[model samples]
Target: MFTRIQAQVLGALGVVVVLGALTLFLVPASEPAPAPVAQPAPEVVDVPEEVPFVTHQVVGTSREGRTIEVYTYGTGTRDILLVGGIHGGYEWNSVLLAYEMMDYFEAHPTAIPADVTVHIVPVLNPDGLAQVVSGEGRFTPDAVRTDVPLGTGRFNAAGVDLNRNFGCKWQPESSWRGTRVSAGTAAFSEPEAAALREYVLAHMPESVVFWHSKAGAVFASECHEGVLPETKTLMQTYADAAGYKPILTFDAYPVTGDAEGWLASIGIPAITVEFHTHESMDWAENLAGVTALLARP
Candidate 1:
Protein backbone atom coordinates (compact mmCIF):
# COMPACT_ATOMS: atom_id res chain seq x y z
CA MET A 1 0.00 0.00 0.00
CA PHE A 2 2.97 2.41 0.30
CA THR A 3 4.09 4.79 -2.39
CA ARG A 4 7.02 3.83 -4.74
CA ILE A 5 9.44 6.49 -3.15
CA GLN A 6 8.56 5.36 0.44
CA ALA A 7 9.10 1.70 -0.55
CA GLN A 8 12.49 2.61 -2.13
CA VAL A 9 13.58 4.44 1.07
CA LEU A 10 12.60 1.43 3.27
CA GLY A 11 14.47 -0.92 0.88
CA ALA A 12 17.64 1.30 1.11
CA LEU A 13 17.49 1.34 5.00
CA GLY A 14 17.11 -2.44 5.04
CA VAL A 15 20.14 -2.80 2.68
CA VAL A 16 22.21 -0.49 4.97
CA VAL A 17 21.25 -2.63 8.04
CA VAL A 18 22.15 -5.85 6.10
CA LEU A 19 25.63 -4.39 5.20
CA GLY A 20 26.34 -3.50 8.87
CA ALA A 21 25.49 -7.09 9.97
CA LEU A 22 27.80 -8.58 7.24
CA THR A 23 30.74 -6.33 8.46
CA LEU A 24 30.19 -7.43 12.09
CA PHE A 25 30.20 -11.12 11.04
CA LEU A 26 33.45 -10.74 9.02
CA VAL A 27 35.52 -9.03 11.94
CA PRO A 28 36.98 -11.34 14.73
CA ALA A 29 36.93 -10.22 18.49
CA SER A 30 40.22 -9.42 20.27
CA GLU A 31 41.40 -11.70 23.17
CA PRO A 32 40.68 -10.32 26.67
CA ALA A 33 43.55 -8.16 28.06
CA PRO A 34 46.12 -10.37 29.79
CA ALA A 35 45.85 -10.57 33.60
CA PRO A 36 48.40 -8.37 35.49
CA VAL A 37 51.73 -10.21 36.11
CA ALA A 38 53.24 -10.02 39.65
CA GLN A 39 56.95 -9.16 39.96
CA PRO A 40 59.25 -11.44 42.03
CA ALA A 41 60.30 -10.02 45.49
CA PRO A 42 63.87 -8.85 46.09
CA GLU A 43 66.31 -11.57 47.29
CA VAL A 44 67.27 -11.51 50.98
CA VAL A 45 70.93 -11.61 52.04
CA ASP A 46 72.38 -12.96 55.31
CA VAL A 47 74.78 -10.88 57.42
CA PRO A 48 78.13 -12.29 58.42
CA GLU A 49 78.46 -13.56 61.99
CA GLU A 50 80.94 -11.97 64.37
CA VAL A 51 84.01 -13.88 65.54
CA PRO A 52 83.34 -14.53 69.21
CA PHE A 53 86.88 -15.50 70.19
CA VAL A 54 88.52 -12.21 69.26
CA THR A 55 87.66 -9.37 71.64
CA HIS A 56 88.86 -5.89 72.65
CA GLN A 57 88.64 -3.96 75.90
CA VAL A 58 89.42 -0.48 77.17
CA VAL A 59 91.26 -1.39 80.34
CA GLY A 60 92.35 2.16 81.20
CA THR A 61 93.14 5.60 79.81
CA SER A 62 96.36 7.49 79.25
CA ARG A 63 97.34 10.75 80.93
CA GLU A 64 95.56 12.82 78.26
CA GLY A 65 92.45 10.65 78.63
CA ARG A 66 93.31 8.58 75.56
CA THR A 67 91.99 5.04 75.76
CA ILE A 68 94.46 2.25 76.56
CA GLU A 69 93.00 -0.68 74.72
CA VAL A 70 93.77 -4.40 74.96
CA TYR A 71 92.91 -6.81 72.19
CA THR A 72 92.59 -10.40 73.33
CA TYR A 73 92.58 -13.47 71.11
CA GLY A 74 91.74 -17.00 72.23
CA THR A 75 89.96 -18.24 75.35
CA GLY A 76 92.56 -20.29 77.18
CA THR A 77 93.51 -20.10 80.86
CA ARG A 78 97.24 -19.56 80.24
CA ASP A 79 97.61 -15.97 79.11
CA ILE A 80 100.59 -14.46 77.27
CA LEU A 81 100.87 -10.69 77.42
CA LEU A 82 102.59 -8.77 74.64
CA VAL A 83 103.20 -5.06 75.27
CA GLY A 84 104.57 -2.35 73.01
CA GLY A 85 104.91 1.46 72.81
CA ILE A 86 105.87 1.70 76.46
CA HIS A 87 108.49 4.19 75.22
CA GLY A 88 105.76 5.73 73.05
CA GLY A 89 106.72 7.28 69.72
CA TYR A 90 110.42 7.29 70.55
CA GLU A 91 110.24 3.58 69.71
CA TRP A 92 107.26 3.74 67.40
CA ASN A 93 108.38 0.58 65.65
CA SER A 94 107.37 -1.39 68.73
CA VAL A 95 103.82 -0.13 68.43
CA LEU A 96 103.82 -0.97 64.73
CA LEU A 97 105.10 -4.44 65.48
CA ALA A 98 102.40 -5.02 68.09
CA TYR A 99 99.74 -3.93 65.63
CA GLU A 100 101.24 -6.23 63.03
CA MET A 101 100.98 -9.08 65.47
CA MET A 102 97.35 -8.19 66.09
CA ASP A 103 96.66 -8.13 62.37
CA TYR A 104 98.26 -11.55 61.96
CA PHE A 105 96.24 -13.07 64.78
CA GLU A 106 93.07 -11.50 63.49
CA ALA A 107 93.65 -13.03 60.06
CA HIS A 108 94.77 -16.39 61.42
CA PRO A 109 92.70 -16.89 64.53
CA THR A 110 93.71 -20.53 64.71
CA ALA A 111 97.39 -19.60 64.78
CA ILE A 112 97.02 -19.22 68.52
CA PRO A 113 97.39 -22.56 70.27
CA ALA A 114 94.53 -24.21 72.13
CA ASP A 115 96.25 -23.85 75.50
CA VAL A 116 97.23 -20.20 75.23
CA THR A 117 95.47 -16.83 75.28
CA VAL A 118 97.18 -13.85 73.67
CA HIS A 119 96.68 -10.29 74.95
CA ILE A 120 98.18 -7.38 73.09
CA VAL A 121 98.57 -3.77 74.25
CA PRO A 122 99.68 -1.95 71.14
CA VAL A 123 100.17 1.47 72.73
CA LEU A 124 100.62 1.70 76.49
CA ASN A 125 101.65 5.35 76.36
CA PRO A 126 99.24 6.82 73.83
CA ASP A 127 100.13 10.39 74.84
CA GLY A 128 103.79 9.91 74.05
CA LEU A 129 102.85 8.13 70.84
CA ALA A 130 100.53 11.04 69.97
CA GLN A 131 103.44 13.41 70.54
CA VAL A 132 105.05 11.98 67.41
CA VAL A 133 102.31 10.19 65.42
CA SER A 134 99.29 12.01 63.96
CA GLY A 135 96.52 9.41 64.37
CA GLU A 136 94.94 7.50 67.20
CA GLY A 137 94.90 3.71 67.88
CA ARG A 138 96.44 2.38 64.65
CA PHE A 139 98.95 4.45 62.63
CA THR A 140 101.31 4.02 59.70
CA PRO A 141 105.05 4.64 59.20
CA ASP A 142 104.29 7.77 57.16
CA ALA A 143 102.55 9.27 60.18
CA VAL A 144 105.87 9.30 62.11
CA ARG A 145 107.91 12.49 62.05
CA THR A 146 111.33 12.14 60.42
CA ASP A 147 112.77 15.14 62.27
CA VAL A 148 111.86 13.91 65.73
CA PRO A 149 114.64 14.11 68.32
CA LEU A 150 116.15 10.88 69.66
CA GLY A 151 114.52 11.37 73.07
CA THR A 152 111.35 13.01 71.83
CA GLY A 153 108.04 11.36 72.80
CA ARG A 154 109.89 8.93 75.05
CA PHE A 155 108.14 9.76 78.35
CA ASN A 156 104.51 9.92 79.37
CA ALA A 157 102.61 13.21 79.64
CA ALA A 158 103.72 13.33 83.30
CA GLY A 159 107.35 13.27 82.09
CA VAL A 160 107.94 9.98 83.92
CA ASP A 161 109.93 7.15 82.39
CA LEU A 162 107.25 4.45 82.51
CA ASN A 163 109.90 1.71 82.32
CA ARG A 164 111.40 3.18 85.48
CA ASN A 165 108.12 3.55 87.35
CA PHE A 166 107.83 -0.09 88.46
CA GLY A 167 108.64 -1.35 91.93
CA CYS A 168 111.71 -3.53 91.41
CA LYS A 169 114.92 -1.75 92.48
CA TRP A 170 112.88 1.44 92.14
CA GLN A 171 114.48 4.81 92.77
CA PRO A 172 113.27 8.40 92.53
CA GLU A 173 115.46 8.77 89.43
CA SER A 174 116.57 6.10 86.94
CA SER A 175 119.38 6.05 84.39
CA TRP A 176 118.73 5.45 80.68
CA ARG A 177 122.00 5.22 78.73
CA GLY A 178 123.70 7.27 81.48
CA THR A 179 121.06 10.04 81.21
CA ARG A 180 118.98 10.35 84.37
CA VAL A 181 115.20 10.16 84.00
CA SER A 182 112.37 10.57 86.48
CA ALA A 183 111.06 7.28 87.92
CA GLY A 184 107.76 8.91 88.81
CA THR A 185 106.89 10.11 92.33
CA ALA A 186 106.89 6.53 93.59
CA ALA A 187 106.34 2.96 92.43
CA PHE A 188 103.54 2.94 89.85
CA SER A 189 102.81 6.60 90.59
CA GLU A 190 101.97 7.25 86.95
CA PRO A 191 98.48 6.16 85.98
CA GLU A 192 99.72 4.23 82.94
CA ALA A 193 102.17 2.27 85.05
CA ALA A 194 99.50 1.76 87.69
CA ALA A 195 97.09 0.39 85.11
CA LEU A 196 99.64 -2.08 83.81
CA ARG A 197 100.50 -3.08 87.37
CA GLU A 198 96.84 -3.67 88.14
CA TYR A 199 96.40 -5.73 84.96
CA VAL A 200 99.47 -7.86 85.74
CA LEU A 201 98.25 -8.45 89.28
CA ALA A 202 94.74 -9.30 88.16
CA HIS A 203 95.52 -11.60 85.24
CA MET A 204 99.02 -12.83 86.17
CA PRO A 205 100.05 -13.81 82.66
CA GLU A 206 102.11 -16.96 82.24
CA SER A 207 104.77 -14.92 80.48
CA VAL A 208 105.21 -11.46 79.00
CA VAL A 209 107.16 -10.09 76.08
CA PHE A 210 107.84 -6.37 75.93
CA TRP A 211 108.85 -5.01 72.53
CA HIS A 212 111.58 -2.36 72.31
CA SER A 213 113.80 -1.09 69.51
CA LYS A 214 117.44 -0.66 68.26
CA ALA A 215 118.90 -3.19 70.70
CA GLY A 216 118.85 -6.20 68.30
CA ALA A 217 118.75 -8.58 71.20
CA VAL A 218 116.52 -10.53 73.62
CA PHE A 219 117.38 -9.59 77.20
CA ALA A 220 116.15 -11.62 80.16
CA SER A 221 114.56 -9.88 83.14
CA GLU A 222 115.75 -9.96 86.79
CA CYS A 223 115.31 -8.29 90.19
CA HIS A 224 116.25 -9.38 93.75
CA GLU A 225 115.60 -13.04 92.82
CA GLY A 226 117.90 -12.76 89.81
CA VAL A 227 116.47 -14.47 86.69
CA LEU A 228 113.84 -17.18 86.86
CA PRO A 229 115.04 -20.50 85.37
CA GLU A 230 112.06 -20.47 82.98
CA THR A 231 113.18 -17.03 81.83
CA LYS A 232 116.45 -18.51 80.58
CA THR A 233 114.55 -21.14 78.58
CA LEU A 234 112.21 -18.49 77.17
CA MET A 235 115.11 -16.22 76.19
CA GLN A 236 116.92 -19.05 74.41
CA THR A 237 113.69 -20.22 72.81
CA TYR A 238 112.85 -16.82 71.35
CA ALA A 239 116.43 -15.87 70.52
CA ASP A 240 117.15 -19.16 68.77
CA ALA A 241 113.94 -18.98 66.77
CA ALA A 242 114.31 -15.33 65.81
CA GLY A 243 118.12 -15.47 65.35
CA TYR A 244 118.47 -12.68 67.90
CA LYS A 245 121.32 -12.52 70.43
CA PRO A 246 120.25 -13.62 73.90
CA ILE A 247 121.69 -11.76 76.88
CA LEU A 248 121.29 -12.62 80.56
CA THR A 249 121.10 -8.98 81.58
CA PHE A 250 121.17 -5.46 80.10
CA ASP A 251 124.53 -4.42 81.60
CA ALA A 252 125.28 -1.64 79.08
CA TYR A 253 123.90 0.79 81.66
CA PRO A 254 121.94 0.85 84.91
CA VAL A 255 118.14 0.66 84.68
CA THR A 256 116.03 0.98 87.83
CA GLY A 257 112.31 0.40 88.45
CA ASP A 258 112.12 -1.46 85.15
CA ALA A 259 108.88 -3.26 84.25
CA GLU A 260 110.67 -6.51 83.30
CA GLY A 261 112.60 -6.43 86.55
CA TRP A 262 109.35 -5.92 88.46
CA LEU A 263 107.89 -8.99 86.75
CA ALA A 264 110.92 -11.00 87.80
CA SER A 265 110.51 -9.80 91.38
CA ILE A 266 106.99 -11.18 91.38
CA GLY A 267 107.98 -14.59 89.87
CA ILE A 268 106.64 -13.83 86.39
CA PRO A 269 108.97 -14.58 83.51
CA ALA A 270 109.43 -11.58 81.20
CA ILE A 271 111.81 -10.62 78.39
CA THR A 272 112.63 -7.55 76.36
CA VAL A 273 112.61 -8.32 72.65
CA GLU A 274 114.42 -5.42 71.03
CA PHE A 275 113.97 -4.88 67.32
CA HIS A 276 117.02 -4.25 65.10
CA THR A 277 115.93 -0.70 64.27
CA HIS A 278 113.36 1.95 65.07
CA GLU A 279 111.87 1.76 61.57
CA SER A 280 111.47 -1.92 60.70
CA MET A 281 109.22 -4.48 62.43
CA ASP A 282 111.29 -7.58 61.48
CA TRP A 283 107.96 -9.32 61.09
CA ALA A 284 109.12 -12.77 60.02
CA GLU A 285 111.72 -13.14 62.75
CA ASN A 286 109.38 -12.08 65.54
CA LEU A 287 106.50 -14.15 64.20
CA ALA A 288 108.72 -17.22 64.23
CA GLY A 289 109.82 -16.39 67.75
CA VAL A 290 106.24 -16.01 68.94
CA THR A 291 105.22 -19.23 67.24
CA ALA A 292 108.13 -21.08 68.86
CA LEU A 293 107.23 -19.65 72.25
CA LEU A 294 103.60 -20.69 71.86
CA ALA A 295 104.63 -24.21 70.89
CA ARG A 296 107.04 -24.57 73.82
CA PRO A 297 106.24 -26.74 76.90
Candidate 2:
Protein backbone atom coordinates (compact mmCIF):
# COMPACT_ATOMS: atom_id res chain seq x y z
CA MET A 1 0.00 0.00 0.00
CA PHE A 2 3.05 2.33 0.41
CA THR A 3 4.38 4.38 -2.49
CA ARG A 4 7.71 3.41 -4.23
CA ILE A 5 9.58 6.52 -2.83
CA GLN A 6 8.59 5.68 0.74
CA ALA A 7 9.69 2.04 0.35
CA GLN A 8 13.14 3.15 -1.01
CA VAL A 9 13.68 5.51 1.95
CA LEU A 10 12.82 2.74 4.43
CA GLY A 11 15.45 0.37 2.79
CA ALA A 12 18.23 3.06 2.95
CA LEU A 13 17.56 3.70 6.69
CA GLY A 14 17.81 -0.01 7.48
CA VAL A 15 21.27 -0.28 5.71
CA VAL A 16 22.68 2.82 7.61
CA VAL A 17 21.56 1.40 10.99
CA VAL A 18 23.35 -1.96 10.32
CA LEU A 19 26.61 -0.22 9.12
CA GLY A 20 26.71 2.08 12.18
CA ALA A 21 26.37 -0.89 14.58
CA LEU A 22 29.30 -2.78 12.82
CA THR A 23 31.60 0.29 12.80
CA LEU A 24 30.96 1.01 16.58
CA PHE A 25 32.78 -2.26 17.69
CA LEU A 26 34.39 -4.03 14.67
CA VAL A 27 36.88 -1.14 13.84
CA PRO A 28 39.52 -0.86 16.68
CA ALA A 29 40.43 2.73 17.68
CA SER A 30 43.88 3.88 16.33
CA GLU A 31 46.69 3.00 18.82
CA PRO A 32 48.64 5.92 20.36
CA ALA A 33 51.75 6.91 18.26
CA PRO A 34 54.71 4.59 18.86
CA ALA A 35 56.90 5.78 21.76
CA PRO A 36 59.82 7.65 20.08
CA VAL A 37 62.59 5.11 19.64
CA ALA A 38 65.59 6.09 21.81
CA GLN A 39 68.42 6.44 19.37
CA PRO A 40 71.62 4.74 20.53
CA ALA A 41 74.14 7.25 21.90
CA PRO A 42 76.52 8.24 19.10
CA GLU A 43 79.78 6.33 19.31
CA VAL A 44 82.57 8.42 20.82
CA VAL A 45 85.96 7.65 19.32
CA ASP A 46 89.19 9.22 20.53
CA VAL A 47 91.77 10.15 17.91
CA PRO A 48 95.39 10.76 18.76
CA GLU A 49 96.91 14.19 18.12
CA GLU A 50 99.86 14.34 15.72
CA VAL A 51 103.19 15.48 17.09
CA PRO A 52 104.73 18.57 15.47
CA PHE A 53 108.22 17.10 14.98
CA VAL A 54 107.07 13.94 13.18
CA THR A 55 107.04 13.91 9.38
CA HIS A 56 107.15 10.55 7.59
CA GLN A 57 108.23 10.24 3.97
CA VAL A 58 109.32 7.69 1.40
CA VAL A 59 112.80 8.67 0.24
CA GLY A 60 113.43 5.77 -2.13
CA THR A 61 112.69 2.13 -3.05
CA SER A 62 114.58 -1.02 -2.12
CA ARG A 63 115.96 -3.79 -4.30
CA GLU A 64 112.75 -5.84 -4.05
CA GLY A 65 110.84 -2.59 -4.73
CA ARG A 66 109.85 -2.09 -1.08
CA THR A 67 109.42 1.51 0.05
CA ILE A 68 112.33 2.98 2.03
CA GLU A 69 110.73 5.32 4.56
CA VAL A 70 112.39 8.29 6.20
CA TYR A 71 111.17 10.01 9.36
CA THR A 72 112.26 13.63 9.33
CA TYR A 73 112.27 15.78 12.44
CA GLY A 74 112.45 19.59 12.33
CA THR A 75 112.61 22.06 9.42
CA GLY A 76 116.14 23.40 9.77
CA THR A 77 118.56 23.83 6.86
CA ARG A 78 121.44 22.19 8.77
CA ASP A 79 120.29 18.65 7.99
CA ILE A 80 121.71 15.50 9.60
CA LEU A 81 121.15 12.12 7.95
CA LEU A 82 121.04 9.03 10.16
CA VAL A 83 121.00 5.56 8.63
CA GLY A 84 120.47 2.14 10.19
CA GLY A 85 120.30 -1.47 8.99
CA ILE A 86 122.57 -0.79 6.04
CA HIS A 87 123.72 -4.37 6.60
CA GLY A 88 120.04 -5.32 6.73
CA GLY A 89 118.58 -7.72 9.33
CA TYR A 90 122.06 -8.86 10.25
CA GLU A 91 122.18 -5.64 12.25
CA TRP A 92 118.50 -5.17 13.04
CA ASN A 93 119.29 -3.78 16.48
CA SER A 94 120.66 -0.70 14.73
CA VAL A 95 117.30 -0.25 13.04
CA LEU A 96 115.59 -0.65 16.40
CA LEU A 97 117.80 2.06 17.83
CA ALA A 98 116.92 4.36 14.94
CA TYR A 99 113.20 3.81 15.58
CA GLU A 100 113.66 4.58 19.25
CA MET A 101 115.37 7.86 18.35
CA MET A 102 112.50 8.74 15.98
CA ASP A 103 109.96 8.07 18.72
CA TYR A 104 111.93 10.19 21.15
CA PHE A 105 112.11 13.17 18.76
CA GLU A 106 108.38 12.86 18.03
CA ALA A 107 107.40 12.81 21.69
CA HIS A 108 109.82 15.54 22.73
CA PRO A 109 109.93 17.96 19.83
CA THR A 110 111.96 20.43 21.88
CA ALA A 111 114.64 17.78 22.39
CA ILE A 112 115.78 18.32 18.79
CA PRO A 113 117.88 21.46 18.55
CA ALA A 114 116.29 24.35 16.64
CA ASP A 115 119.01 24.61 14.01
CA VAL A 116 119.21 20.87 13.25
CA THR A 117 116.99 18.71 11.03
CA VAL A 118 117.25 14.98 11.57
CA HIS A 119 116.44 12.49 8.81
CA ILE A 120 116.29 8.84 9.87
CA VAL A 121 116.22 5.93 7.43
CA PRO A 122 115.46 3.08 9.80
CA VAL A 123 115.89 0.21 7.38
CA LEU A 124 117.87 0.80 4.18
CA ASN A 125 117.81 -2.84 3.08
CA PRO A 126 114.20 -4.01 3.06
CA ASP A 127 114.67 -7.31 1.21
CA GLY A 128 117.27 -8.43 3.69
CA LEU A 129 115.12 -7.26 6.60
CA ALA A 130 112.21 -9.35 5.27
CA GLN A 131 114.49 -12.39 5.26
CA VAL A 132 114.95 -12.07 9.03
CA VAL A 133 111.62 -10.53 10.06
CA SER A 134 108.36 -12.45 9.64
CA GLY A 135 105.86 -9.60 9.27
CA GLU A 136 105.79 -6.14 7.71
CA GLY A 137 105.99 -2.74 9.42
CA ARG A 138 107.25 -2.60 13.01
CA PHE A 139 108.99 -5.65 14.43
CA THR A 140 110.22 -6.77 17.84
CA PRO A 141 113.36 -8.62 18.98
CA ASP A 142 111.52 -11.94 19.01
CA ALA A 143 110.57 -11.45 15.36
CA VAL A 144 114.21 -11.97 14.45
CA ARG A 145 115.55 -15.40 13.51
CA THR A 146 117.99 -16.34 16.26
CA ASP A 147 119.46 -19.36 14.53
CA VAL A 148 120.56 -17.41 11.46
CA PRO A 149 124.29 -16.90 11.08
CA LEU A 150 125.89 -13.49 11.68
CA GLY A 151 126.39 -13.04 7.93
CA THR A 152 123.17 -14.73 6.84
CA GLY A 153 121.09 -11.57 6.64
CA ARG A 154 123.86 -9.25 5.45
CA PHE A 155 123.23 -9.26 1.68
CA ASN A 156 120.29 -7.96 -0.36
CA ALA A 157 118.09 -10.03 -2.70
CA ALA A 158 120.61 -9.22 -5.44
CA GLY A 159 123.37 -10.85 -3.33
CA VAL A 160 125.09 -7.51 -2.83
CA ASP A 161 126.61 -6.46 0.46
CA LEU A 162 125.17 -2.94 0.62
CA ASN A 163 127.71 -1.53 3.05
CA ARG A 164 130.43 -2.39 0.56
CA ASN A 165 128.53 -1.05 -2.46
CA PHE A 166 129.34 2.64 -1.98
CA GLY A 167 131.55 4.64 -4.32
CA CYS A 168 134.55 5.06 -2.03
CA LYS A 169 137.46 2.87 -3.09
CA TRP A 170 134.87 0.44 -4.49
CA GLN A 171 135.82 -3.01 -5.66
CA PRO A 172 134.08 -6.03 -7.18
CA GLU A 173 134.62 -7.96 -3.94
CA SER A 174 135.20 -6.78 -0.38
CA SER A 175 136.32 -8.63 2.76
CA TRP A 176 134.10 -8.95 5.77
CA ARG A 177 135.98 -10.99 8.38
CA GLY A 178 138.11 -12.29 5.52
CA THR A 179 134.99 -13.93 4.01
CA ARG A 180 135.19 -11.90 0.76
CA VAL A 181 131.63 -10.65 0.15
CA SER A 182 130.53 -9.32 -3.22
CA ALA A 183 130.61 -5.51 -3.13
CA GLY A 184 128.59 -5.22 -6.38
CA THR A 185 129.42 -5.07 -10.08
CA ALA A 186 130.45 -1.46 -9.49
CA ALA A 187 130.09 1.45 -7.07
CA PHE A 188 126.46 2.18 -6.18
CA SER A 189 125.53 -0.75 -8.40
CA GLU A 190 122.82 -2.07 -6.08
CA PRO A 191 119.53 -0.22 -6.02
CA GLU A 192 119.63 0.26 -2.25
CA ALA A 193 123.12 1.78 -2.39
CA ALA A 194 122.25 3.81 -5.49
CA ALA A 195 119.18 5.30 -3.82
CA LEU A 196 121.24 6.31 -0.79
CA ARG A 197 123.88 7.85 -3.05
CA GLU A 198 121.24 9.88 -4.87
CA TYR A 199 119.74 11.08 -1.61
CA VAL A 200 123.10 12.11 -0.16
CA LEU A 201 123.93 14.02 -3.34
CA ALA A 202 120.58 15.77 -3.40
CA HIS A 203 120.42 16.74 0.26
CA MET A 204 124.14 17.28 0.87
CA PRO A 205 123.56 16.89 4.56
CA GLU A 206 125.92 18.63 6.97
CA SER A 207 126.69 15.29 8.64
CA VAL A 208 125.91 11.59 8.24
CA VAL A 209 125.80 8.76 10.80
CA PHE A 210 125.66 5.05 9.99
CA TRP A 211 124.82 2.69 12.86
CA HIS A 212 126.38 -0.78 12.98
CA SER A 213 126.90 -3.56 15.58
CA LYS A 214 129.55 -5.50 17.60
CA ALA A 215 132.31 -2.95 17.04
CA GLY A 216 132.19 -1.28 20.47
CA ALA A 217 133.69 1.93 19.14
CA VAL A 218 132.87 5.20 17.35
CA PHE A 219 134.72 5.65 14.03
CA ALA A 220 135.40 8.58 11.74
CA SER A 221 135.11 8.21 7.98
CA GLU A 222 138.10 8.52 5.65
CA CYS A 223 138.42 8.34 1.88
CA HIS A 224 141.53 7.25 -0.03
CA GLU A 225 142.55 10.90 0.01
CA GLY A 226 142.29 11.18 3.85
CA VAL A 227 139.86 11.78 6.68
CA LEU A 228 137.91 15.03 6.77
CA PRO A 229 138.97 17.31 9.68
CA GLU A 230 135.31 17.57 10.76
CA THR A 231 135.09 13.77 10.95
CA LYS A 232 137.31 13.79 14.07
CA THR A 233 135.09 16.37 15.73
CA LEU A 234 131.91 14.31 15.05
CA MET A 235 133.53 11.07 16.23
CA GLN A 236 134.77 12.66 19.45
CA THR A 237 131.46 14.39 20.08
CA TYR A 238 129.45 11.14 19.86
CA ALA A 239 132.07 9.13 21.70
CA ASP A 240 132.41 11.64 24.56
CA ALA A 241 128.64 11.71 25.08
CA ALA A 242 128.07 7.93 24.77
CA GLY A 243 131.23 6.99 26.73
CA TYR A 244 132.60 4.96 23.84
CA LYS A 245 136.21 4.94 22.59
CA PRO A 246 136.63 7.01 19.44
CA ILE A 247 138.84 5.30 16.88
CA LEU A 248 140.08 7.00 13.71
CA THR A 249 140.74 3.76 11.87
CA PHE A 250 138.87 0.43 11.61
CA ASP A 251 141.95 -1.71 12.45
CA ALA A 252 139.95 -4.95 12.43
CA TYR A 253 140.44 -5.10 8.68
CA PRO A 254 140.70 -2.91 5.58
CA VAL A 255 137.21 -1.86 4.59
CA THR A 256 136.56 -0.69 1.03
CA GLY A 257 133.52 0.96 -0.49
CA ASP A 258 132.38 1.82 3.03
CA ALA A 259 129.37 4.14 3.37
CA GLU A 260 131.02 6.56 5.76
CA GLY A 261 134.08 6.70 3.55
CA TRP A 262 131.89 7.58 0.58
CA LEU A 263 130.39 10.44 2.59
CA ALA A 264 133.90 11.68 3.30
CA SER A 265 134.67 11.41 -0.42
CA ILE A 266 131.93 13.98 -1.01
CA GLY A 267 133.29 16.21 1.84
CA ILE A 268 130.49 15.42 4.33
CA PRO A 269 131.44 14.50 7.88
CA ALA A 270 130.27 10.97 8.68
CA ILE A 271 130.67 8.50 11.56
CA THR A 272 130.01 4.85 12.26
CA VAL A 273 128.62 4.48 15.75
CA GLU A 274 128.91 0.75 16.29
CA PHE A 275 127.06 -0.84 19.19
CA HIS A 276 128.80 -3.32 21.53
CA THR A 277 126.53 -6.27 20.80
CA HIS A 278 124.18 -7.45 18.08
CA GLU A 279 121.33 -8.23 20.52
CA SER A 280 121.21 -5.04 22.56
CA MET A 281 120.36 -1.57 21.14
CA ASP A 282 122.49 0.24 23.75
CA TRP A 283 119.66 2.76 23.79
CA ALA A 284 120.89 4.93 26.64
CA GLU A 285 124.36 5.36 25.22
CA ASN A 286 123.23 5.98 21.64
CA LEU A 287 120.52 8.34 22.81
CA ALA A 288 123.08 10.41 24.69
CA GLY A 289 125.28 10.34 21.61
CA VAL A 290 122.43 11.50 19.35
CA THR A 291 121.36 14.18 21.80
CA ALA A 292 124.90 15.50 21.82
CA LEU A 293 125.02 15.47 18.01
CA LEU A 294 121.72 17.39 17.78
CA ALA A 295 122.92 20.01 20.25
CA ARG A 296 126.02 20.69 18.15
CA PRO A 297 126.55 24.10 16.43
Candidate number with greatest lDDT: 1
Per-prediction count of colliding residue pairs?
Answer: 0, 0
Model 1 misplacement above 4 A? 1-51
Model 1, 192-223: lDDT tens digits are 88889988898999899999998899999999
Whole-model Cα lDDT per candidate?
0.91, 0.88
What tens digits encode model 2's per-residue C-alpha lDDT throughout 1-297?
A: 979999999999999999999977676678654799999999898876654566888877887888888889987778999999998888899989988888888888888787888999999998888888878888889899877776667899888899899988999998898788999999988888888888889889999999999788999989977878899999999999998889998878878898998999989999999999988999999999988898888
**Superposed Cα RMSD, model 1:** 18.2
TM-score to true structure, per model: 0.82, 0.81
Model 2: lDDT to the true structure: 0.88
For residue 200, model 2's alpha carbon misses the true position, in angstroms, by: 1.1
Cα lDDT for residue 41, candidate 2 = 100
